[model samples]
Target: EKTVVLITGCSSGIGLSLAVRLASDPAKTYKVYATMRNLAKKERLLDCVKGLHKDTLDILQMDVTDQRSVLDARQRVGEKRVDILVCNAGVGLMGPLEAQSLDTMRQILEVNLLGTISTIQAFLPGMKTQGHGRILVTGSLGGLQGLPFNEVYCASKFAVEGVCESLAILLQHFNIHVSLIECGPVNTNFLDNLQAAEPGSSGEQVDARTQSLYEMYLQHCGTVFQNAAQDTDDIVKIYLEAIQSASPAFRYYTNSALLPITSPKTAASDGLQYIKTMSKIIFSTNNKVEQK
Candidate 1:
C-alpha cells in the first residue's frame, strides 16, 4: 500500500521536486496528486514524470485561494482520504512598507494563511476518523525572524507557524502528525514571484532612506541566493524523512547555516539585541565585497 499525497503549487521549485521524488520512488511508496493553479502551466511537471508509472502521479488544477477550486480538486480525488497533505502553495511580497499595497498584503494572507486553513479544514475530519495522517507545511525562517522588506511575507509565515504549532498539539491524540518545513533561501522562483513594488509606488510613496534600505536588502538576499541557497533536491530529502518518520518532528529546519538568523532564542530575551543584530545583517556591506 502507498501513501496518497496531495501537494499544492507543484508547477516548479520544491513542490515539483518533492512530487517527482515521491512518485518516482523505486519502492513505489507514494501516489502523488501534484496540483498547480493552472493546468496550462503543468508542462514542466509532465515532462519530468514522463517515464514514471502514470498511476503513481496525477496532475490536477487547484488554486488554493479559491474554495471552489480546492473542493473541486478534492472531489476529483474521489476517495476523500488523503494520507499525506503538503500545503506548499504560497506567494511572496517584498519592498518598503510605503511601497506595498493593502491589496498585496491581503493577497499574501489569503493564499498563504487562509489557503492552509481551508485545506486543513477540508481534510482533517477524514484524518481524525482514520487515526493516521501526516500534514506538512512549507514554512520559512521568516516565520521565526522578521525580515526588513518582507513584512507581509514574514507575517504570513509567522501566522502559519502558530497555526501549525497549535494543530500539532491538537492532532496528536488522533495520531495525525503535523510537520512544518522551515526553509531558508531555497533555489526557487519565490523571489521572482514576489509582488514587485506597485508600479510607481516605490518612486512615489517610498522616501529616499527607505528606498535605499529596500535596495540594500535585495542586494543582500541576492548574495545569499547565489552562495547559500539549498537545492530543491536537498529539501525533498528532508520532506521524505518527515513523511517516513514514525516519530515525526514538529518543525524541520533545512538550512543549518542560517541558524543564527532563524533562532530567535539565541538573541537577548529583551528582543532589542535581535532587532539590532538583524538590521546589521540585513544591511551588511559584505555582499558587495563578495560580489567584487
Candidate 2:
C-alpha cells in the first residue's frame, strides 16, 4: 500500500521537487497530495508530474492562512490516516522591524506560525488514532540564526522550532513523531514573494530613519547570503528519510555549510563563532594593509 503523504506549499522549489521524486519511486509507493495555494499558477508543475502513475499524485488546493480553506482540505483528506504530514507552507518577510506595519507583522505570524499550528491540529487526531504518523515542518537557517532584515520571518520559524520540539516530546506516548527540517537558501520563489509593509498602510510607509536603516541592512544581507548557493538534494533526502524510516529522527539540517547547524546550542555557538571570526578578520586585515 502506498503511504499517504500530504504536503503543503507544493507550487515550487523543495516541495515540488520532493513530490515529483517521491511519486516516481517505484520501490516505495506514495499517495502524495501536492498542495498549493493557487493550482492555476501551477500549470508547469501539473505538466511535469503528468507522466507519473495516476495513483501517485493528487493536486490539492490549500491556503494555510485561511481556516475555511484548511478545513475544506481536511474534509477532502477525511478518515484517510495520513502516514506523513509535511507542513511546508510559509512566507518570508524582510525589512527593518520598524518598517513593517503592525498588521503586516501580524499577518506573517498568522501565516507561518498559526497556519502550521492549524495544519497540525487538523491532521493530528487521525494520526493519533492510527497509532503512528510523521510530521515534518520546514524551518529556515534564519530560524537557527537571526538574519539582519528577516526579523519577523525568523521569529516565525523560531516559534515553529519550539512548537515542534514540544510536540516531539508530547506525541511520544501516542507513537507519533514530529520533526523539523531546517533548510538554507534553496532556489525558490520564497524570496520574491516575501511581504513588505505598505508605506502608507500605517501612519507612514516608513520614516527616513527606518528606510535608511532598512536599505543598509538589505545591502549587507545581499553581500553575505549569495542567491541559490546551496545544494538542495541533501535536504530532500532528509525529508524522504523522515517519511520512510521507522526509527525517524527528531530534527535535521540541510544547507551548504558542512555542519548541520539547527539545534539551539549549535545556533548560539555559530553566532559567537561568527563574531569571533569577523573580529579576527578585521584585525588581521588592518595589520596587513593600511587603509588607502
Candidate 3:
C-alpha cells in the first residue's frame, strides 16, 4: 500500500516541489493530495507534474485559515486516512512593528500559527485512530530566532514551534510522530509572496533611524539569500529523511551552517546575546558597507 500523503500550500515553493517529487517517485510509493488556497493556481502544479500523475496525485482546494475548508479537504482524501500530513501553508510579513497594521499581523498569525493548528486538528483524530502517522511542518529560521523586520512573522512561527512541541509529546503515545523541517533562506517565491512594508512608503509612520535600519536589513537579507539560500530540492531531502526514519527527530535543521546563529539564544539564558549578535551581524555588516 502506498503512503497516503497530504501537503498544504501546493501552489508553489517547498510544498509544490515536495508534492511533485513524491508523486513522481519511481516506485509509485506515494499518493499525494496537493492542496492550495485557490484551485485557479493549480495549473502550475499540474504543469510541473504533467498528466502522468492521475493515480498518484490529487489536487484539493484547501484554505488553511478556514476551518471548514480544511475539514472539506480532509473529507476529499480518497484513502480516508492521511499517513503523512505536511502542514506547509504559511506566509511572511516584514516591516517595523509600528508600520504593520493590526489586520496584517492577524493575517500572519492566522495562517502561520492557527492555520497549522487547524489543519492538524482536522486530521489528528484519524491519525490517532490509525495508530501510526507522521506530521511534518515546514518551519523557518525566523521561527527559531527573531529577525529585525519580521516581528509579527517570528511571533507566529514561534507559536507554531510551541504547538508542534506540545503536540509531539502527546502524539508519541499514539504512535504518531511530529517533525519540523526548520529551513534557512530557500530559492523560492516566498520573498515575493511576503508582505513587506517599504520604508519609503511608510513615510512618517516609521522614524528615519528605523527606516535606515530597515533598508540595511533588506540589504543584509539580500546578501544572505544570495550567499546561502538552499534550493527546494535540498529541503525535500531533509523531509525524506524524517519520513523514512523509524524514529524521526522532533526538529531537523536544513542548513547546519545557519544553526550556530541560533545557538546564542540557548547558550545565553537571558536572550540578550542573540539579540546583540544578530544586530551586529545585520547592522554592523551594513555599516561597514556604508563606510566603504
Candidate 4:
C-alpha cells in the first residue's frame, strides 16, 4: 500500500521540489498529489517532473483559504487517507507596512496561517480515524526573530510556529505527529510576488492601519531588505526527512546561520540587544549636544 502525500503551493520553489522528490522514490511507496492555485500555472512543475521520468505525480487544485476548496480536494484524493500533508502554500507582500492594505495583511494571514489550519482540519479526521499521520507546517526564520520591514509576514509565520508547537502536544494522544520547518531565506519566487495594495488611491486601502505601524518600524531600520538566502532544495530536504523518518523531529531549521547560538558561559549575547543598547547611547549623546 502506497502512502498518500499531499502538498500545496506546488507551482514552483520548495513545494514543487518536495513533490517531485517524493514521487520519484520508487521504493518509497508514495502516491503524491501536488496542488496549486491555478493548475494551469503548473507548467514548470510539470516540466520538472517530466525531466525526472516518473508518472506517479498527480496534479490537483486546492486553495487553502476556502473550506469548500479543501473539501473538494479531499473528495478528489478519495478513499486514500492522507498519510502526510505539507502545508506549503503561502504568499509574500512587501512594502512599507503603512502602505500595505488591510486586505493584503489578511490575505497573508489567511493563506499562511488559517490556510494551514484548514488544510490540517480537512485531513485530520481521516488521519485520526486511521490512527496515524504526519503534519508538516512551513515556518520561517522571520518567525524566530523580528526582522525589519517584514512585520506582517513575520507575524504570520510566528503565529504558525506558536500554533504548530501547541498542535504537536494536542495531536500526541491520537498517534498523529506535527512538525514545523523553521526555514531561512531560500531561493524562491517569494520576493517577486510582493505587491502594494493600491498603486494610487485617495481612498482607504485594506490594510492601512496595520501598514501605518509597519511604516514606523521601517524608519528605525534604515534598510529596506536583507538577503539571507539558500537554495530551495535545502529546505525541501528537511521537509522530506520529516515525512519519511520513523521518528521525525518536531522542529528543523534549514539555514545554519540563523540558528540560535548558545555558549556555556553566556547564552544572553543577543546581537540585536547589543545594537539597541548602542543606538540608545548614540541618541542620548546627540540629545545632550542639541541642548548645549
Candidate 5:
C-alpha cells in the first residue's frame, strides 16, 4: 500500500520538489496531496510534475497560518488519513529588530510556530489511532543558533525546534515519529517572502553604527548563501531518508558547514562561553565585511 502524504507550502522550493519527487516515484509508493495557500499559485508545481504520474498527486488549497483552513484541508484528504504530515509551510521575517513591527513578528509566529502545531493537531488523532505516522518539519540551522538581524525569524524557528523536539518524546509511545529537518541556506523564495514584510521607521531613525552593523550582516549573509547554500533537491533527499527510515532521527541537519554555529552551546558547561564565542565569531565576520 502506498503511503498517503500531505505536504504544505508545495507551490515552490523544497515542498514542491518533495511533492514531485514522491509523486513521480517509479515504484508508486507515495500518494501526495500537495497544498498551498492559494490554488492560483500552483502552476509551478503542476508544471514541475508534468511528466510524472498524475494520479499520484493532487493540488489542494490550505493556508497553514489559518486553523480553519488546516482543518478543512484535512477533511478534503481522502478518508481523512495522513500517513506522513509535512509541516513545511512557513514565512520569513528579516530586518533590524527595532524596525520589525510587533504585528509582523506575530504573523511569523502564527505561521512558523502555531501553524505547524495546528497542522499536526488536525492529523494527529488519525496517525495515533492507526498506530503509526511520520511528522516532518522544515526547521532551520538558524533555529539552533541565533543570527544577527534575524531576531524575529530565528525566534519563530527556535520555537518550532522546541515544539518538534517535545512532540518527538510525547508521540513516540504511539509509534508516531516527529522529525525536525534543520536546514541551512537553501535556494528558495523564503528570502523574497522575508523581504516582503512591511518596514518600520527605525530604518530611518537608527544611528550610523546600527545601520553599519545591519549592512555588514547583509553583506556577509549574501556571501554565505552564495558559497554554501544547498539546492532544493539536496534537502528533498534528506527528507526522503527521514520518511523511509523505520526508526527516524529526531533532528537532521541539512547543511553541515553551518553546524559550527550550533556546537558551542553544548561545548560549554553553562552556555555563557557559547554566547561569547558566537558573538566574537559574528563580530569578526562583520569586521571583515566592513573592511570590504
Candidate 6:
C-alpha cells in the first residue's frame, strides 16, 4: 500500500516541490494530495508533474484559513485516511511593528498559526483511529529566533512551535509523529508573495530611524538569501529523511550552518545574547556602509 501524503500550499515552493517528488517516485510509493488555496494556480503544479501522475497525484482546493475548506478537502481524499499530513501552508509578513496594520497581523497569524492547527484538527481523529501517522510542518528560522521587521510573522511561527511540541507528547501514545522541518531561507517566491510594509504607505508614520533600520534589514535579507539560501530540492531531501526514518525527531533543521545563530537563545538563559548577536549580524555591515 502506497503512503497517502497530503500537503498544503501546493501552488508553489516547498509544498509544490515535495508533492512532485513524491508523486513521481520511481517505485510509485506515494499517493499525493496536493492542495492549494485556488485551483487556478494549479497549472504550475500540473505542468511540473508533466501529466504522468494520474494515479499518484490529485489536486484539491484548500484554504487553510477556512475551516470549512479544510474539512472539505479532507472529504475529498480518496484514501479516506492521511498517513502523512504535511501542513506546509503559511505566509510571511515583514515591516516595523508600528507600520503593520492590525488586520495584516491577524491575517499572518490566521494562516501561519491557526491555519496549521485547523488542518491538523481536521485529520487528527482519523490518524488516531488508524493508530499510525506522521505530521510534518514547514517551519521557518524566524519561528525559532526573532528577526527584525518580522514581529508578527515570528509570533505566529512561535505559536506553531508551541502547538507542535505540546501535541507531540500526546500523539506519541497513538503511534503518530509530529515533526517540524525548520528551514532557513530557500530559493522560492516567498519574498515576493509576503506582505511587506512600504515606508510611508500606511496611515501611521514610522520614525526615520526605524525606516533606516528596515532598509538595512532588507539589504541584509538579500545578502543572506543570495549567499546562503538552499534550494527547494535540498529541503525536500531533509523532508525525505524524516519521512523514511523509523523514528523521526520532533524537529529537523534544514540548514545546519544557520543553527548556530539560534544557539545564543539557548546558550544564554537571559535571552538577550541572541538579540544582540542577531542585531550585529544583520546591521553591522549596514552600519559600516553608512559610515563609508
Point to the candidate with the largest lDDT: 6
Model 2 alpha-carbon drift over 4 Å, by segment: 198-201, 204-213, 256-292
TM-scores of all predicted structures: 0.94, 0.84, 0.95, 0.80, 0.93, 0.96
User: All models: lDDT?
Assistant: 0.87, 0.77, 0.92, 0.76, 0.85, 0.92
**What are the candidates' C-alpha RMSDs?**
2.8, 4.2, 2.4, 6.1, 2.6, 2.2
Q: Candidate 6 on 128-165: residue-level lDDT in tens?
A: 99999999999988888889899999899989999999
Give lDDT tens digits, candidate 2, residues 93-169.
Answer: 98666667888989899989999999899989989988988899988877765665678998998899888999999
Q: Single out the weakest 10-residue window by summed lDDT for candidate 5.
A: 195-204
Local lDDT at 15 for model 4: 90
Greater TM-score among 5 and 6 belongs to: 6
Ranking by lDDT: 6, 3, 1, 5, 2, 4
Q: Compose the digit string of candidate 3's lDDT tens values, residues 29-80.
A: 9999999999999999999988879899999999999999999999999889
Tell me how many clashing residue pairs each candidate has: 0, 1, 0, 7, 0, 0
Candidate 1 worst ten-residue window by lDDT:
259-268
* Candidate 3 ranges beyond 4 A from true positions: 198-204, 286-292
Between which residue pairs do clashes occur in model 2? 199-205
lDDT tens digits by residue: candidate 4, 1-292: 7888999989888898888888887585788889988888888887877755354678889989989988888889854689999998888656555556677889899998899889988999999999999998888766765554577887888888888888899899888889988876677777677444454332445467556545554443322225456777888788877777998889888877656322321425555563453334323435456545
Clashing pairs for model 6 are none
How much is 198 displaced in model 5, in angstroms? 4.8
Clashes, model 3: 0
